[model samples]
Target: MRLISRLNPAEGVGDFWAYIRRPQPYRWPILGLSMLMTGTLLFWVLQERYYLPPERPQVTYITTFAPGRTDEEIIASNIANEARKDALAAEQAERDEIRREIYRTFGRAAGMDVEKIEREAAAERAREEAAEKARREALIGESIAEPAE
Candidate 1:
């Protein structure tokens, strides 16, 4: 406190502020201008909150082949499909992983819960089988109709 008082301005150092203390002719106009500016800023902020738009939704679709085809044929038709998916999933998982590693690479990259991923993959496979079954049924629709005994 003693050190701060030593740095204070002297009693007789009056200058600009002394002359401005009296009610000048322009004081009312200056005060009104300041109030107008403050009100305009508040109005703009309130208007902005009401006028903003909502977020848009994002959607994606992935196409897959029908099942019942030979393993070789299916693999050939979609050679890099599994690899591509694995690579992307692995990359996303790496971003989420806390540890840097070599041996756990596949697990780290595949970030999904093992059981959940397996279930989803199985469901996808079943859908493919169902699609193939429907295709076959459509092809054989009237050809194998029963004859009267």
Candidate 2:
């Protein structure tokens, strides 16, 4: 506060304060200009906030629904009825296929031959996994050592 008072003398009025007390010729014009600007800002704010905007929507969304319809409301109504029809039909078809397969006695059932083949596949997979692990570890070791060097 003292610093600000230093710019204008404590004893006498400053130039700006003096000019404000005894106005110049263009003071009324400046005041009018400020009032005009404030009115313009107020008008713009009222138009934007209080008044309704134009009905200009994006092209993709314009075709989706009517004016009053929202995407969420449409989806919420359709989710339990129309959307589940196709899904339920597909699920029933899958269950029927599984039921038919369980009744059939022609195909190879779960037995020793299947176990033997599975064991061989698992052994092969383990070997491939160990090789891949060794290769990845070697690459990682090389990467780490190169940075240090």
Best lDDT among the predictions, by candidate number: 2
Cα lDDT, model 1, residue 133: 76
Provide the overall lDDT of each model, using Cα atoms, as 2-decimal numbers.
0.72, 0.73
Model 2 accuracy (lDDT, Cα): 0.73
TM-score of each: 0.24, 0.23
lDDT per residue, candidate 1, 20-88, as tens digits? 467699976887999999999999887744556767767666657664678898877676888888899
Q: Count clashing residue pairs per candidate.
A: 1, 0
Local accuracy of candidate 2 as per-residue lDDT tens digits, 35-146: 9999999998888545678889767644644668888888887886676898899999999878755644323464335445657878999999999978987777656454
Pairs of colliding residues, candidate 2: none
Please report how far candidate 2 places residue 79 from its true position, in Å. Answer: 25
- Candidate 2: residue 147 lDDT (0-100): 65
Off by over 4 Å in 2: 1-112, 142-149
Which 10 residues in a row give candidate 1 its minimum summed lDDT? Answer: 96-105
